[model samples]
Target: MKKFLEVAEKLAHEKPLGPKYRNRRLVGNFKGRWECHIEPGWLLVYLKTDQEIIFERTGTHSDVFK
Candidate 1:
């Protein structure tokens, strides 16, 4: 949790980190949103706008996707 927050903070301040963070744009109904892996099944979903980064969800794969 601590490490995830640290990385999330960095992502919010800087440009997308890269593959290490598993940052990728979501498709389908989730189009326009982006996601980053925190662990094996844990993920953080969010949207990046011109003014701010909006976090939409954070949880395990099942929980987040559902």
Candidate 2:
């Protein structure tokens, strides 16, 4: 599959800061949008410029990650 550069850059540019355990690694893309994977199997989805909602992916956690 093709990697979405826009989504990748957006996810990289906007990151939630913290003292420890940066959650920024949660970044991913879905349905033409850039999303973040927070919990073990939950996707924290939203538009690039706003907050988001938790969701589920159809594939295994590892498969959907990349």
Candidate 3:
């Protein structure tokens, strides 16, 4: 989970992640949230506000979206 934490730290610091993370806003049931790839299929879902960042979930695409 080191990679996940690394990305979380970056988000916490407002640092831009590399393209590999594929960070982007989400829609549908997850509207207003953001998602990023941690590895091939693993993903991290979160929400960012002026006050703090809220992590919602982390898992493979199917695992998280299911």
Best by lDDT: 3
- TM-score comparison, 1 vs 2, better candidate: 1
Per-residue alpha-carbon lDDT of model 3 for 1-66, expressed as tens digits? Answer: 788889989999999999999999999999999999999899999999998999999998988999
TM-score per prediction, in order, is 0.85, 0.27, 0.94
lDDT of 2 at 41: 57
Which pairs in model 2 have colliding backbones?
A: none
**Over 4 Å off, model 3:** none
lDDT of 1 by residue, 1-66 (tens): 796887678877875566767889999989999899877678899998988888899988889998
lDDT of 2 by residue, 1-66 (tens): 122233344355664533232234333345444344443454434444355422334233566565
Whose TM-score is higher: candidate 1's or candidate 3's? 3
Q: CA lDDT, every prediction?
A: 0.84, 0.41, 0.93
Query: What ranking emerges by TM-score with the best candidate at the front?
Result: 3, 1, 2
Off by over 4 Å in 2: 1-13, 16-32, 50-66
Model 2 TM-score on a 0 to 1 scale: 0.27
Instruction: Report residue 6 deviation for candidate 2 (angstroms).
Output: 23
